[model samples]
Target: MPKSSLVAALSALALTGCSHADDGGPAAIAARAPLQWRSMATPHDRDRLRDWRKAWKTALPRARAFAPERTAAEGALFNADLALPGATPPIGEYRCRTFKLGAAGPAMLDFIAYPWFRCRVTDEGEALGFYKVSGSQRPVGLILRDSPTRAVFLGTLVLGDEQAALQYGADPNRDMAGFIKRVGDRRWRLALPYPHYESLLDVIELVPADSARETP
Candidate 1:
């Protein structure tokens, strides 16, 4: 074979081997994406939240009866002094926004005109148990599972209080959950499938409340 052809063949082989090592298969990439929100807040290219926000608003009133209910048992689960970052919302008020792990994302999600939850903590340690589900002021349960480094919060049911943390855990296989990776960090994602099942969207973002002019 010609020297040039031989060299080209070697290069192609090297490239193939490299790609196989980091194949970046679709499922593998998507799997790591959920954890990516811990450091960055990337939104999907289409920003489906814009479209879904409208749908959430349209269905808010009607979604009440179908809303998940928060129970007394859930509140006692993580009530202990568990060390988790941003376990409590934050000192400054923040509004929850949709979060993702891809291109065209927001550093601080917009708290303006979305199913966002606006909240704040105090100087003393006040942990955030749960926030309202999208659309309505009612909370869709947050079950806590604490680890040495992170706290796993599963959104299970609905809380009646408009401005309180969800302090419990219930359904597991039938709930959507998120992890707070940072210690005392409030920036996390909540993959909520509220109003109904089959809506496993990850567009939620948690940004400071006074950070912007957009208020509910």
Candidate 2:
């Protein structure tokens, strides 16, 4: 299929509703979140999060080969093992940008850098609510505290003007799982490995929205 047609098809799928036994409201979503979030992710996502280091290793050089300046500018963001101690970010608005590395197919670009977008980290009783408020493909979900240096992000993508997001485990195609880590003083990164889209890994760099209105 042509690229436009493929995108249109994906948008259609995002708007369609599918019944799921596990799908429920926010409270219910939080209730199932504990250690169960790991099981909620697809098998591939599980492996992706587990072998995230490999994803970075395979993607960085490939991305550098094509967009060396852009890739090099990322600096510490590309370091897979540079996670800081405090993985949890405070409740507030954040400025985030996306860097997609390693093309998944011939039609995709080797590296793509998206401009700044608005994101929010809310205090959702059981887990923090992470929402990419502005973007064509928004990911809204719960951030469960996993360890001292990391947190597990379990969420699904919301496309276009869709008001509702799919349940995390409802659709494999829409499901998103990643690890959130604080990389700098007030900077954090969400590392999503082996995504189901155009890139092998998706790194979202985030910082307080109050900072300079530029890339994080």
Candidate 3:
């Protein structure tokens, strides 16, 4: 069966509403995760999702080694433990950029930052949709509320020539999970760790396009 079909089938059996219990590991934390994410992430990815700090610890120092000045200049963009309240970003266009840290392979750069691109956040009833509309590699996913300080990001990447994104569980290699948090009044970030790609940690900084110039 297709992953999307399987997800739909299984979702029928999983608890449909929020569960206040925080025990019994990732599967038990239904209230904090989207339906697709809870069903799709591997045990290891779930651990990565819950304890994302490990990825930060592993990546930040390596990035700093390569570009201390640049890394330092990023400030909260590079801070792993700086999530603030009001994790959801308002629906609208945003100026976003990718900052990769800790190369996964010897041939890749330890730290690399990309220029700003366009992204959007949409209200999807059960969750908010986040899509990077500009870039060779784009991320499109649902942002489900996790806590007052953060939200769970469950989505997949859209590579060149792809007209539409794959279902979150369709391809484990393309699957992306992370935390979205508000770092400042109008600044938000999606922090993905130990991605199935070149970087150990990928931070996507987002700010309202209209107010990008005022970001501090």
Model 3 vs. true fold: TM: 0.82
Scanning candidate 1 in windows of ten residues, the lowest lDDT window is 37-46
lDDT of the candidates, in the order given: 0.34, 0.77, 0.77
Question: 1-216 in candidate 3: lDDT tens per residue?
Answer: 222332332233344343544454333343345655555455655877976888899899999999999999888878777889999998999999998999999999999999889999886544677889889999887777778898878777899878777755557898788999998879998999888899999999999988735333
The model with the greatest TM-score is 2
> Against the true structure, what is each candidate's TM-score?
0.34, 0.82, 0.82
Q: State the lDDT of candidate 1 residue by residue for 56-160, as single tens digits.
A: 343332222232232121222112222344443444555664422121223322111244565432331112334443444433332233444454443334434
Instruction: Tell me the deviation in Å of residue 8 in model 2.
Output: 30
- For model 3, where is the 10-residue window of minimal lDDT? 1-10
By descending TM-score, how would the candidates be arranged? 2, 3, 1
Model 1 regions more than 4 Å off: 1-88, 99-127, 137-149, 159-176, 182-186, 191-196, 213-216
**Model 2 has how many clashing residue pairs?**
0
Q: Positional deviation of 73 in candidate 3, in angstroms?
A: 0.7
In candidate 2, how many Å is residue 165 off? 0.3
